[model samples]
Target: MNPAQTTSQQPRQDSPHKRADARRNHERVFAAALEVFEEFGLQGTVPQVAERADVGKATVYRSYPTKEDLVEAVVRHRLAELDRSTAPVLAEAEPARAFETYVILLFENLARDRLLSEALAEGRSSRNTGPLLDRLAALMDQAKTAGRVRPDACPLDLRVVLCGMCLQLINFAERDPALWRRYGELTLQALRP
Candidate 1:
């Protein structure tokens, strides 16, 4: 075979431009998957996500080989969003205010994202939550040192409390929309010294 023909038959290298395109496609698929999953929960399928993404199903599969992998990716994305949104609040000089703001932000985010609320409610282990938990622990330590949070209050306790409130808020959203803020306030009070 001619060298030119052999070169043409070989797989093309992923050049910088190709990599940029791939990254854009990956983001599109991820955004679409998050939307579909939020609307339909775990019942959403890869085909549906692909349709929403305006990309081929094979493209989605190339990035995320399985539904579970896609779900995990979406979850990680949402968790990262949560971290970004809450980080500044957690860093405030007033520890009590920081803790309150963090909890309120978390409650709002979880209430808005039904799929994430369900995933968290299921209590499944996720590597994505590690950083969020670390942040929470740091916030809790700050609050404790400032004498705003009770001495016995641990990060795990705060996690459980927040998760419990979020689960209730989600389960009763249709019945009572006001319960979310009510529960959020109650949770805040419970965390105070």
Candidate 2:
């Protein structure tokens, strides 16, 4: 190869590395955001996440411009995870058990995840809730057909009950992690046929 051509055509090796570094930074910021929000709910701050991730605030802002944007992203990611976890519960042989298990799982996750709990309780960013709702509704219907739940049980009814439970549990669940499960059992009992 000609010397000048070789020099002029030298690949920008740093470009790929820069892209990979950017992706790693994004993943770090996302994981940090998840941890911060899980602990602090929506009250968590980008600066706190940046500190946790050991990245600059500008780095987080580069990928997520605002707090709301960051929250929406986190919520979407969490919802996807929650949805994935439903598969096993949905596959249970007994309809009532499936419904009850799903409810308990939701309560456990909410009790442990302040941001998701708060977001759901406050009814913000509801678009991503559709799939979970559909799955829950399906389970509820199966339970109803199996003569497990009370006649009036509906998906909205569960949401209302869940929101109320979250409100009651949010303040104390951290102190007593099992409290949400207790409430989940009570909620299940109340729904019995």
Candidate 3:
């Protein structure tokens, strides 16, 4: 083969080591963001995350591009996880148990993910309850049919009740886990038929 022809090549994709390094950096950046957000709320600076991650500020910006983008990405990632965990609860045949379990899982999610709790506390989650309402409505209908919930329990009402429960738990998470646990059951009881 001609030497010049043999030398021709396609551009390289990221190598395995490069990809692994990128993954590690990504995780570090996210971890840093989580810590910063937990400490300073959503207003936490990107530089803070970079410092915490021990990465350059430009690296953080390259990963997230914008503050809102970073916040949105983290929130969505957490919510997606919450959704996956609740999917099984929603699929359960028993309505009351399903609803109760769903709330419990949601409370757990809020308790674990500080950034998510802060976002909820900031009222950013209010605008995105459509899927939540749909799921709750369907579950409530099943529970009603199963004679588990009250007769007048609509999905929207259930959504409001769940939102209230979540907010209450979030407000009380720092002060008292027991309080949230108590109210969690109470809220579930109220939804029971």
Better of 1 and 2 by TM-score: 2
Stretches off by above 4 angstroms in model 3 are 1-23, 38-43, 84-96, 120-130, 168-175
Model 3 scores worst on lDDT over the 10 consecutive residues at 121-130
lDDT (Cα) of model 2: 0.81
Better of 1 and 3 by lDDT: 1
By lDDT, the better pick of 2 and 3 is 2
Taking all chains together, the TM-score of candidate 2 against the true structure is 0.85
Clashes of each: 0, 0, 3
Candidate 2 residue runs with Cα over 4 Å from true position:
1-11, 123-125, 172-175
Q: Estimate, for each residue in 1-193, the C-alpha lDDT of model 2 and write its tens digit.
A: 8998777766576678889999999999999999999989988999999999999999999999999999989988998888788776667647767888888888788777888878777532267656666676788788888888888898777767766677767655452557778888887787787
Q: Would you estimate the TM-scores of all the predictions? A: 0.77, 0.85, 0.70
- Indicate the residue-level lDDT of 147 in model 3: 82
Per-residue C-alpha lDDT of model 3 across residues 1-193, encoded as one tens digit per residue? 7776545632134467677887899899998887787556566889898999999988888788998777777776767777888776677736556766776665566655666756654432353434555665676677677787888887656656766666665565563545556666776788876
Each candidate's lDDT (Cα)?
A: 0.77, 0.81, 0.69
Rank the models by TM-score, top first.
2, 1, 3
For model 3, what is the alpha-carbon lDDT of residue 30?
93
CA lDDT, candidate 1, residue 109: 73
Spell out the clash pairs found in candidate 1.
none
Q: Tell me how candidate 1 scores on lDDT.
A: 0.77
